[model samples]
Target: MNSLKHHILSGLFMWVLSMQAQQRPNILWINADDLGLELGCYGNLDLKTPNIDRLAKQGVLYKRAYATAPICSASRSSMITGMYPTSVNSQDHRTINMTPLPDGIEPITTYFRRAGYFCSNGNSHNMSRGGKGDFNFLAENIFDGTDWRQRKEGQPFFAQVQIHEPHRDFVKDKEHPISADKVTLPACYPNHPLLRADWAMYLESVQACDKQVGIILDRLEKDGLAENTIVFFFGDNGRPHLRDKQFLYEGGLQVPLIVRYPDHFKSKVIEKELVSLIDVSATSLELVEIKLPNYLQGNIFLGKKASKREFVYGFRDRAGDAVENMRSICNGRYKLIWNRTPDRPWMQLSSYKKAQYPAFSLYNVLYKKGELAAPFNQFMVATKPEIELFDLKKDPLEFNNLADSKKYQKIKEQLFQEISTQMVAFEKNRIPEGEKTIEKAKASSLKYYVEKIKTHNPLFTADTTDEELLKDWENRLLKK
Candidate 1:
């Protein structure tokens, strides 16, 4: 009888062990900035990105994935909070780093830690660059390039790493052609060599980021954590160029979202389902059995058949704030952009409108002289038709603004209602004014970006000696 009992208990134990092993899978989230669907898996052969491509092959690729906001601060804020920018009231456009991660919101890291997982991250972007909020990475601004293996041991761990190599700084190369000759132009932008070269440089930055991603994945396999981890790769927002980063167009708000889970999720799949970065926090929480909070607006994208968000919304606010700056609202298929300050230079607002692009400068001179007036000049002049709408199918580049057209009234009406509803919600739940109201709030928000925007007086002049305000500005920016 004792021998028989022992046999039964041993068999039962084995069965329970199998069940537990099948249930818990480690999670690793790798977020890159401005990287679009130009991967080998996404079908761009100009660059060689094997590791990330491997993850896409093994997991699922969400082709129509999007960021909640076009700019860095707002988009990242949406990701950390699991709520739309307006819902959080942090959608002031670019002041994300102006405040600490909002209070009462549980960051993904904190949630994972509560659920018995260790977390760490690596990112090189200026912490002030984004609204670096309350997601609990162990240390800020300190993740070395590719040393993810040195994190704590004994328990299953989750690591979220960020790579910014593909941002703006480095984008010049050859053979891996990202230049003008092979450039695809959005009708909003003029197709010229300078624009093409500019686009190529940005693409190169993305490819360089891929090389780093490959190295990190190799570390995972080499360290024996390959089978136990889940890998998710995505961009922070759209590309960093003019219309891409600050606008509500497809190129600016839509990002490539890919996920690779070990054996639990293995297959080449494309999910037409729309998922927002905001949902990432909730999804991570659900994976670890932590209760997803009620305050969060994001739902888990668990490949489960019952996810509830029909359309994703995006936000844009206070880009430069001089004039022509505005806010936007996007539902996966259609987007509405509102220009509150319309007198600003439209084309000059773009980061790519450099003097290096002789044609651009020539056009700018003509525009100022009242000679050139197309959509480009109209855009630079902060021209507004109240609501700008686009159908993603016909114009993936989002160049043609269809708000004033006779046919798209239904589209405009539908989006207007959605944007109004979400904005009301955002104002209610966001943080307090915190010892400041209007003017002070603006200063607080503009602490980091103000120097560049406010340059006409004592600085921004060519005669001034070299200044160290960059460092001082960075430090002040971080404190707020």
Candidate 2:
């Protein structure tokens, strides 16, 4: 009888465990566009992000999280697929249309969907354009719908909510406006009123983003899903500033990451693991007990089989209206940037970047007036070294390039060899060419997009079109 009782108890325990697995928690991914680790929780006292701060306090905050690429579509594409943008031929800042993913590779959402999880690109309200998770690949088959509301009853969900706040055209908050005088400026930028105002406006947008985060959390609680939901928050790329956006600097590549894994993880813990945004897919898969596919290059940094990465890689390709190539590798303390197009100037003309970009325009004015200083003028440098290295510990701003230093030559060669090996492993082109071909493609793509817009709205002619309008059209076209 005792033996029978033992068997029954064991069966009951197995049944309980099976039920827990069946009730697999929902995954909520919140990504902020063009944002860095500038929140209150990240020790930035300038911005008021109490809601995000609270979330960080209740979760695991990563201090050294980096994005695979620094531009929007490239970074997001790399992020969603767990593949480098260059490897998938999506390294460009924006594509003419929704470029399909490379052969035999599918979005990470496909795996979630296959595992009986309803995959969505927004919240659970069926709101369109709910979040701007702009990846270069098409999303028609990836997202079952805009939100998890379309899912069958009793099914779990994996949802991504993108916050477009703190991007360009920073909307001000009159109720609690962040004063320009109180805002702290990056030493690289000038202490001009316009620059300060730009910084203040960005802080206000951050506040707005925090409020949105609070709303999402409240909605989860209202729906009685908070206890069983794993919420992940991170930035899609870096800050929206000129040097911080498309460049491979610390300000461009590093982003904030917070994860609240329901009851599984300890609260208020700071995780200092060297993590890449591409790792998000692998981490989520492990958390959900799904086997990761072989094609994914990202390492899992959570759950029972977590592993730490020694170095994080970054890539930069063609930006809007310009063709360029740059690659970077960072091993937490030191960083190396390889500029394939060293002859090109930093301030290449991009209709999208120049329009509605306050910092870029202001910097251009400063450059013309010969008022730009030190690191601020670095953005306008006509020629850069083919390879640049920095000891991030000593030069936080990355102003001094130690690539040419005799003492650091050994370190520079090591990083160069390491990065080069990685590039070969990923099948990345060490030397990019055909600048004229790329520019032609951009012009053809833009012309085709303008024609399409004109078809719908007859008033959107070449003469009548404004730079802002063109920028929006380009964005829409790139997303297809």
Candidate 3:
């Protein structure tokens, strides 16, 4: 009688484990490159994004979502680690072979993998992307394949699909390209024909990305995974434009975030609380009843009992060879920026950026002729103040500087202290590397990349005779 009872208890324990495994929902994260909050659902009427709008209608849309870092690889690194980039020493804009993530830190996907989720880091539609990870640290065995089709039978999944659109070198498609005349220009940009054309091309790229999102959603439905999968759509960073992509201003960090899971979340709701991209991993784990580790800094924002965030932080460091260091703190209405290297010009030399946009080239002409207008000319100043304070509620474009205002002293002091405390906790050092070290890092990166490319293409040979080609390659490596 005792043996029979013990056997029955063992069977019941296995049955409970199977039920828990079946209850976990699949997670799908779609991250777009350099896309700002310009979607139709985000109050930008000039752009056409029907698919994303429908997703918003069926999900929760966040109005105040931001990336911890504004650049590509840095932001992605922070996101995957669920911590601030500065904390992990990954805030530099360009990283070569690998970044030294902190000893205890690991990619958030590793935890999901241990929990029996079949993870992937590519499109669900099986699109080819040349297999470029582009992340700061190594990613091995974290992602099983490019799509969910490679997952074991009856296993839950966590997939990420990255859409490269609205970034610099915008796509120009034949299918109803955006009209230059109809595009609405930002107040900080000059209204030139060339600038308008650039804006139109960016909007066109957004449309193409929207269509791609539709394809991914359709694929989920066809695969019968929509009901059990939670979909998150957001931009990896901000828009690729002057004073946007690489800067600490609103355009540089603010991104559109939408989360959809019909079974456990409310539909057609708009959240106005501050949310950071770092919260994504924690939120996903919460959906499956997993407790976030104590080391994670992000809070869960998807569940019914979500709490509001008091402040969101942003960091910038060593963008290309420019050697910039800055930090910012925002409370959704006011923003405070501390420019560590105030003497450095905002428009530092970046071959990667200057080649794509008319900011530097045309700004020189406009400044010489005194044709540049307000807000547009502000960014062209040779030097900036050590500190900048802006009431975002009033100056959405971040035009007027209120750091020196006596009336706002209390507010400014509060934010400054908060940011300083956080920075100390993270052990963030704002000192730029020495000139020799910066040059060494650049040369080492160039050698590694040149050799890696040659390894992939055995027939290719470096042109020793062409000085321009070597220079261009070095510049690209610096911009990598």
Candidate 4:
């Protein structure tokens, strides 16, 4: 009876297709959680994402796409409202779970829904912002596993389908068939069996999401809504893990993005343009020939494209029961990091918490002794230098610190200036800089996410057992 009712409803709604007003094209956005460019199209050597790769062949694949915030909620929020995290007064990831939102940070769907487009989010409404949760426009549930083709013809629609796979549960490092053995891992972490197994599961999730993408595309074609629909597929942020999820590294912020509009766009292109998830607003809005809002901070990456950015910015406000505050600015050539807590370091938010995970403990030992691999030691364990500048051209892994080098003085000066300017702008948009200092980073992290995570710190080691201490730098440093 329920299935009959749905079919009857679908047939009745299909009748609405006869009358075609000057309505906008349908919008379908499929986003993955904690995903990067890990498909065949995005250069994931481990797996074959035939569907995602097919979409790339049919559309334009972005080379340098980025998430506005490395953390999920912040990036997701920015994409919805088309604004920077700081602009929304959401610069600090800690406040996401703490403070109430400022005005006008609501979902743009409210605006689109008001404009007569049927808006729905299938399944995962994994949004981090917008206090209004009561606005349900669907007849019953937007999360009924329906894609854009499921809608009635001639009725303009906007559908968002999200996938939350390959997240946290990959902790055991269990193998998932397809793997990342060829994919390089940072040196701060050691190569281990458990880690490999965990990564394989992560790959399996990507492949699984890819399979779902195939289903949606097939439906779009079967329903004959192919040409009129604009499809955008991407990740909410970089992968969810230690350095990637909570920290502002490329592995965290950089993601694969693709846009497809059959009737429009002439080029099957590869744009190395630096773009953030916030700019996704521009692409969506422009496809419908609508003017972007003035307040949106991101530049339009397509449709009368402008000069691409030199260096985009990323932030790490909080994650995994801890707040690891940081601000980073990256150009294709260089990157500069502003660690909010520059003094006290090495608070394990991921590996240490799960001490059984050797990646964390193993690196802990090497990092403390300043003996980790090139970029791992440079990026993961190099105690916060307050301001870190690296020539990305020379150090793609971001393993070098050129802040003190005179050889790259000009590059350093330019980056420093650019970062400073960005900081001021961010400050203006941020909560007032009160008397907060990094005096007790560890304590502050524990206090902030005290409720979210269980206590999972490493076993304290004695100074005399430095050799067998696993990776206890704090013991050696403070003689603990």
Candidate 5:
């Protein structure tokens, strides 16, 4: 009779554990590559993103969401680990040698899996090959499978769906093509016909990405998981454009963020608080009733007890062959950028920029001809200011420079001190990769770009100056 009682008690305990697992909300992260605040929900009426707009209406929309890093690998590394990329020596884009994460620190998936959550990562369109995990740290056993459907019966899940759209090689939406005439170009960029057409193509790609989001949401509802799933849709970084993807400017750092959880988070709420992409990690763990690890730098920005950040920081390290070290701090109203390597030109010799960005050639040609405008021309200079201060409230496009202005000296100094303090803290726990590794990476990147340029642009010659080559490309683009 004692043995029978033991068996019955064990069965009841197992049943209780199963019920707890089922009660936990399934987390779904839809990460869009190189997308920005151009969605219909973000007040860009020129773009048609019906699905994303509907998602915003169903939940909360963040207006001032920013990524920790402008580049993918660094940004994603922070997002996954809930730690600053600088702290983990993951600041550089595509590090030569990936390092294992710190002893106590692990990917968020590890925590989810420990709590009986089935973790899956896969491309939104294809589930066979898995999704983009461009993390600088070595990640093994991060996910149990490529799709959540493979999980056991009644098991909760943490799934990431990578949507690679609107990055580059912009895929035109044949079904609904956007007109160049209707698009509004940024004042920083030259208002040329070719640029307008390019912008339209980018919008088309964004529209296509919206369709993909709709498909995923529809599937969730069709499978009866939408009601219980917590959905997060956001970009990995800023939009893929000249001076946008690799820089610390708002064009690169700012991204669209939308969250939906039925009966948990309030619907139709527009959150204007400064939120970092890394916060998603902490928020997800909190919503699932998991204790946030002490080492996590991300703040919980969702529940009733959500905290708002006073300042959002961004970092930019070496991107491909071009080496740079820049840091930015924004306190909603003002922003400060500290450039470590001020000697390097803003338009450095980056092969990816030369080939992928048509505007690169156009800018070079226009600058050489003395046709580029004031603030735009500033970027073409051989050297940049070591410090740049901008009043974001007065200058949304970041055209004015107030670093040297005596009136703003107090504000600038305060920001400088805050950033300095933060950097010192980050440096305390940083893992250095040594100078030799960085040099090797620089050499490899340079070699790759040289070979690519020669193979593709036959007109490009060793003797051809930048101005000459750019002029030729510009003429061809205009003609088209």
Candidate 6:
């Protein structure tokens, strides 16, 4: 009889554990690469993103969401680890030698797997493969399977769907082609016909991405998992454009964030509070009733008990062939950017930009002809200012610089002090990767860009002047 009682009690415990797992909400993260705040939901009237607009109406939309880093690898590293990339020595884009995460630091998937959640990382359309992690650190065993369908019966899941769209080599949207005339180009970029066409193509890529979002959401509802699942849709960084992707300007760091969980979060809410992309990991863990680790720098930014951030910080280091260090701090109203390497030009030698960005080429041509003016010409200078301050409320495009103005000196000094303090704190936990390692990486990147330029555009010879290059590019790029 005692033996029978023991068996019954063991069965009861197992049943209770399974029930607890079933009660937990499944977490779905739809991370879009090189996307920004150009969706229909974000008030861009030119773009047609019906699916994403509907999602925004059904959930909370964040207007002031910012990325911790402007580039992919560094921002992704921060997202997975819930820590600043600088702290883990993952600040550089595509580090030369990948290293294991520091002691006691692990990807968020580690915590989820420990609590009986099935972790998955996959492409938006297919769950089997083709997901982009691009983490600077060595991430092994971070996911159990590529799809949530592979999990056992009644098991909750943490799935990340990587949507690679809108990141250069943009395919024409044959179904819903956007007109160049309807698109509005940023003020900093020259208003040329080729640049307008490029902007329109980017919008088309965004529309295609919206279709992928609909597919993922539809599958969730069809499987009857939408109700018990928490959905987060956001970008890995800013949009893929000149003066956008690799820079620390507003266009580079600002991204759209939409969260949907009907049970816990209110619907149709527009959250204007400053939110860091890293907060996604912390908020997801909190919603699933997991205790946040003490070492995590990300704070929960959802639900009623959400923690509000006073300032959102960003860092840029070694993007492509350009080796530079820049930092920014924004308090929702004001922003300040500090360039450690002020001698480097904003238009540094980046082969990827030269090949992929038509507007970049146009800017070069226009600058040589002395057609570029004011704010647009600033980018073509030989060196950048050591410090830049802008009141976002007055100058959203960051065209006006107030760093040296007497009236704004107090505000500038305060922000400078805050950033200095934070940088010092970050240095305390920074990993030392040695100067030799960085030099080796820089050399390799420089060599690749120089070779790429020569091969991709043979007309760009040492003797080819700016005028000759412009005519050649226009003839090649402006063809129907």
Leading candidate by TM-score: 5
lDDT of 6: 0.85
All candidates' lDDT scores?
A: 0.61, 0.78, 0.78, 0.62, 0.86, 0.85
lDDT of 4 by residue, 1-480 (tens): 999999999887655532332357878888877787677886667775888898888888888888878766677656776777766655544342334334545456655554556666664433322121222111133232244434455667777877665554443222335544564444434554445544555677777777778877887788787798888988888876555666666777888888888867653756556887887876677666555566667777777655476778886664434555678888766777777777636354532243223345546666677766665554454357777777656675565777888887787678778877877766555553233422243445444333222232334322223244333323322231
Clash number for each model: 16, 0, 0, 5, 0, 0
TM-score of 3: 0.87
What's model 6's TM-score? 0.92
Q: Assess candidate 3 and give its lDDT.
A: 0.78
Instruction: Rate residue 84 of model 4 by lDDT.
Output: 72
After superposing all C-alphas onto the true structure, candidate 4 shows an RMSD in angstroms of 8.5
Taking all chains together, each candidate's TM-score versus the true structure is: 0.75, 0.85, 0.87, 0.76, 0.93, 0.92
- Compose the digit string of candidate 3's lDDT tens values, residues 1-480: 999999999899866765676679999998888999899998999878999999999888999999998888879877887888777767776654344566777788878876777778784234553222456565566577878767877788888887877676678767776777888998778887667777887888888889889999988899999999999999988999878988899999999999999766777656569999989878888887766777888888877547778899998887665678899999988999999899988976654554455555567567768987876888778998999999998999888999999999999999999998899976452234567767766565455535544543444333322233333333432232
Rate residue 339 of model 5 by lDDT.
94
| lDDT per residue as tens, model 2, 218-320 | 8778888888888999988898876788889988899999999777888765555699999998888888887788989899887899998999998888876
Best by lDDT: 5
Clashes of 3: 0
lDDT of 1 at 410: 86
